[model samples]
Target: MPRKDTCKRRRIVLYAVRSAEFTTSDDRQTVYIVETDHDTYLFILFTSEVERNLYLYAREEEVSDEVKENFTNLANELSFDPEAITYLPKVPVPRRLPCLAPCDCPGDAPRVPSPPRRARPPDGLPRRPYGARSAQRQGLLFRQLFEAESFTYTYLLADPKTKEAVLIDPVLETAQRDTTLVKQLGLNLLYAVNTHCHTDHITGTGLLKQLLPGCRSVISRDSGASADILIREGHALKFGAFALEARSTPGHTDGCRTYVLNDQSMAFTGDALLIRGCGRTDFQQGSPEALYRSVREKIFTLPGDCLIYLAHDYTGQTISTMEEERTLNPRLTLPLEAFVELMNNSNLPKPKQIDFAVPANLKCGVQDVAV
Candidate 1:
């Protein structure tokens, strides 16, 4: 399958075929059907006076053997390269509701109930509802903020009803932008939290506390960083009716923590895990073995549907799910021995801002006074 970003741009378009008709059953034209484990594709080679166009049709699941044979024969006849045919990218199609007929029965007549509609976020964003699980309930407001220099992601989660909010992994450079959004949303900033002491950028917790007087700075007790509140494993940060349980998940750093929502709906996984990859465990008290265990025991143990929000995503990925990371993340999905070897041999360059950022972050983003 193509990458998500690539698939997002996949669209089927039919070129100018002034007058065209389905010639599959007639066997008078070149038509082929290819089958794969997850999907079936139908390819039609249309010959025109000026050019030849390939029209492809994609369907979910298996296709008949006869259709496969037909496609193979057509390909052989045209001397087409087998490698030239490719599966069309998967696209999300809207679910079609069953047809409903007007009821003309007595009041006591039995009626068929309609299927439950999926709930959506207030901003009309799509929600994932698989199998028996229902969509995410309303009242949760989520926004993703970015710091370009560090490629860090700062998340703002709020309980709209209570106007209580929290900012996660905020960078100092983006403090004003984050505060502006908080004020614009009329939200009461309750906490400016860090998943860990970051080496790539200074924490915005101090600046945010200065700007939002009611907000407190928070970090893990083991982080060796000054904060208004130092949390440990099993500690719950509560605001309004929501609570985030802090789960010790040190690997990239000794104090790395994964904050999980009370509902187990999502988790903030700092640098412990990333989209398709993970953080380098070569410095900053980094340990590949410990990180591997942390991911498997702390993060991977969550429900498959639980969203995994990362502190930094170099590939522009905003969020992923436990299920996706479990099956798709190359680093986390590897065997323990393989993962350790990979991490040790990564040989990545050190962060450019580590020298300055680490010291400032140790003091909660405060610079030392001149002697």
Candidate 2:
């Protein structure tokens, strides 16, 4: 299993409080709090005329060392004196004031016995799986596969009547599993397509071709990656009676494309537009401005109800819709200037596998040696 920190995506929201009152006292102090979707924290600073000391306290769950380090760095950038910034040990949970009740016997009455906890599943029992399709339209065969190591999602789409299929953003590590599923479903795998030249994981196109002799590799002509078929903007990748219209939605990378189903039912947005977020634009030929324009003009132009599939999601989200993203995506929903600032200010670390993934992906997942 991956480390807890690595498995979860990092989302830190920092708030600087000019003055905050502590529960124990009415004294106002300069405090900075770091919050995430799950937890809240307080950064307490002790300042004198000439020196300052900083301490961190969690208001809810325990904060990870990685989070502390990140917030500490952020604090320094915000001009906070960090000469003695330290993460204090977990503090005791503060007790609430006793409830006053005249009817209830003796103010404490054993605190009204807590409810019994539900029994958990047996150890041998398998946990619920991920990637199950939440909904499917008539005559469409769709499956979503997740690769945990890279947090990448690969999609398989086929026509129920003809069994002709196309796969999108398949990862090298999950190639065999994907092909096996295709075979088991008795589908005719026609094309292995990539939305862009990914920097985090190698594409499974080459491997799929080697396994399914008739399968062809597809990618954008401008992606600069070798493939059996190099498609340009407006090209239709058809299988059976259905087709996907390749719309040039470059920004996260120069070659990024959003493939919309011919009927406008759905779109597979690569790293260009994610669920409530977007791909980082610090590397791999990324451009914040270009991404903003691409999303606004190309993707946002799709039908409001059109389902939007993503290439990767680290926050356990499976899918979203065009309308949802247009209105709720924190990054894309912002004004152009604010969006650019958000992207530019994102201090994200480079993908750990970028060095090996990029070269192998450039060759469509044909590696020199086996793992």
- Model 1 CA deviation exceeding 4 Å by range: 1-136, 365-371
RMSD of each: 19.7, 21.0
For each candidate in turn, the TM-score is 0.64, 0.63
Per-residue lDDT for 160-261 in model 2, tens only?
789999999998889899989999999999999999999888888888888887988888887777788888999998987678999998889888989997
Q: Please tell me which predicted candidate would have the highest TM-score against the true structure.
A: 1
- Per-residue CA lDDT of model 1 for 158-274, tens digit only, reads 887898998999988889999899999999999989999999998888888888878888888898988888989989888776778999999899999999977666789999989
Count of backbone clashes for each model? Answer: 1, 0
Candidate 2 Cα misplacement greater than 4 A, ranges = 1-136, 365-371
State the TM-score for model 1: 0.64
**Cα lDDT over the full model 2:** 0.70
